[model samples]
Target: MHSQQQGWAEQQDALAEFGQFALSCIDLDLILQRACELVARGLQTPIAKIMQTIPESDELLIRAAVGLPRDIATTGVTKVPGGHGSAAGYTLVEGEPIVSHIPTETRFQVSEVVRRADVVVSANVVIGATGEAFGTLEVDSLAERTFTQADISFLQNYANLLAAALDRHKAHRERVANAEERSILLRELQHRTQNDLAIITSMLRMEARRAKRSETRRRLESVGHRVEALSLVYRRLYVTGVTDAVNLSAYLDELVKRRFLMHGLEHDDAVKLDLHLTPVEVDHSQAVAVGLIVNELVTNCLKYAFPLRQGTVTVTLERVEPGKARLTVADDGIGMPDDQVRGHGIGLELTPVLAKMASGDFTLEQRDAGTAGHLVFYIPDLRGGGSKPL
Candidate 1:
């Protein structure tokens, strides 16, 4: 009686240990091997192994095993045909546990490895959460033994734990795949939107050339330029393959160079361009507002700053502090008249509105030989969490 009580106590301890293994966050293979090891020790078995079904195939492949020959454990014995021919295969197809005393059992052909290893008794149970079986867990003993219902129940419980783990892993993989798919779709949508904007800009340019009156032509041209500026932002986004933030240095360089080429000033010997920019990243909305403001300021300088188009325009962007950045566009030419400086030209009128949209301050001042436009704004740390101005 005392010996039976001691055996019962040991089984309880093994049950607790096995429960911990089931809840562990270890990799699937390691978990399976560890579970097999625990079960072998608990049941006093000489060998334990797990076999998984190959998807779309009628084969049971050994995945993890304990107390088995290295060659058989690693290379895995020949794939067991999925049916009632082998104990593991039968359990998988029937979705039920099987116990056999090899000496007396003739229902299934025993594996050559089991015969060679002198395995006299074996038990196998299906392993999976859903109704369909994924594999089977098995334990074998060298001496002929009768596996009671209680022993079979213990193996079934272990298989159930393994099934739950497989289910959780499948769910995690699906979630990750879905997120990646969504990102690709968003990028494609942004690319198409950029292409559409380019089409509209081209149409507007054609309309401007057909306008009869000089004022009407100028208005159309101005509107077209604004659209072109907006289109450039999306172009950069598509080119860089970055949907979240714009690299300000590269963006401004491209923007200014394009403007120079458009205004027929790229080859003008009288006009010189200088850019002193620092690398910074900003959200899409802020970048668009900044680009538009730059468009207006640079256009104003080309038209009015230099009376004979014979001076230099300098654009600079730099970090002012941890949470601030400043952009300056300065030119050496005839300064704006004090009265006209306050007037509502499209360039001047739009500058302040765009600056406000960008959460920035806009200012214009007369320099020694021309006019200077300055815009200071809060820039967020794009690397960290959402906008924390830095």
Candidate 2:
């Protein structure tokens, strides 16, 4: 008799191992099925069933079962009462564990479907972290058998593990959803950037065509170059997976390389561009304004300043203080004439306008050399976070 009992206990331990392995390998449905199987075998019962709460629904649905016919067990929906009864629903509602040893009728509003079970024993164990009702584990014996506290404790622990697994699945699903949303937003932003570039190109082409003279055409072509520089900044931003703002130094270097320097100025008389930039980030509007301002300054240096000669056009950017920045464009070329200085020319007029857009000031002056010109401007920092380098 002692040897036989020891063998049976070993078999029960093996069944527990199988239950754990099955729960690990299978989905929620299979976990429930495996739970029913384990409980039925451990309790030496003829039938076992697991019931779960339907989200937003007051009814408890039979999720899994063993031994009993599925068709008979789930013939109808079972409405669980709010409190104080022997039914699984009532046990869950009252936040308590319950067990029944015999096929006893309880006024817990258990459906007629469950009334058909001749031998029934059930235990309700709260599984979730918040002590919320996760489900019910039930074992039915055709013969009378004692239900122990150890059995209830085992079922409760397994149910808790099952709840954690379900929560992990839910979190993963939400992460996937959030990733999909970000992908959609990025695609939309790319589409809008392309549209903006196309429009700017069209505008530049029209403006260039309407110019009556070669000089005017040249100037408008320079404007088109500026627009393209701005477009390149956005393109790099899109490629780098950044959409908010851009680093000024890197943007300026890229702009100069792509736009003006591509012309390959060989002679000392030809305009040579240089940059001295401080790390900074600017919003889209300020970036555009800065891009256009640089375009105008560089174009003017190549046109009027050098006057058919080579020259060095230096563009320097430095952070002056917490919220202010200094930008200076110095060209070693013929200084501005007194007559031309009054109106400040169209490009020079744009300098002040761009500076105002940045909420700052602008200045134009002739260097002490008497042959070179300098334009200094200040603009407010838009990025309140940390400074960035392009």
lDDT of 2 by residue, 179-198 (tens): 77885797578667866986
Compare the candidates by lDDT and give the number of the best one: 1
In candidate 1, position 313 carries an lDDT of 88
Predicted candidate 1 versus true structure: per-residue lDDT over 210-294, tens digit per residue? 9999888888887878888888888877766677788877788888888887888875568999999998888888999999988
Model 1 stretches with alpha carbons more than 4 Å out: 1-50, 54-58, 61-79, 92-128, 132-169, 337-340, 384-390
Model 2: residues >4 Å from true position, as ranges? 1-183, 195-212, 262-270, 337-340, 370-390
How good is model 2 by TM-score?
Answer: 0.53
Pairs with steric clashes in candidate 2: 250-390, 268-310, 269-309, 269-310, 270-310
Q: How well does model 2 score by local distance difference test?
A: 0.64
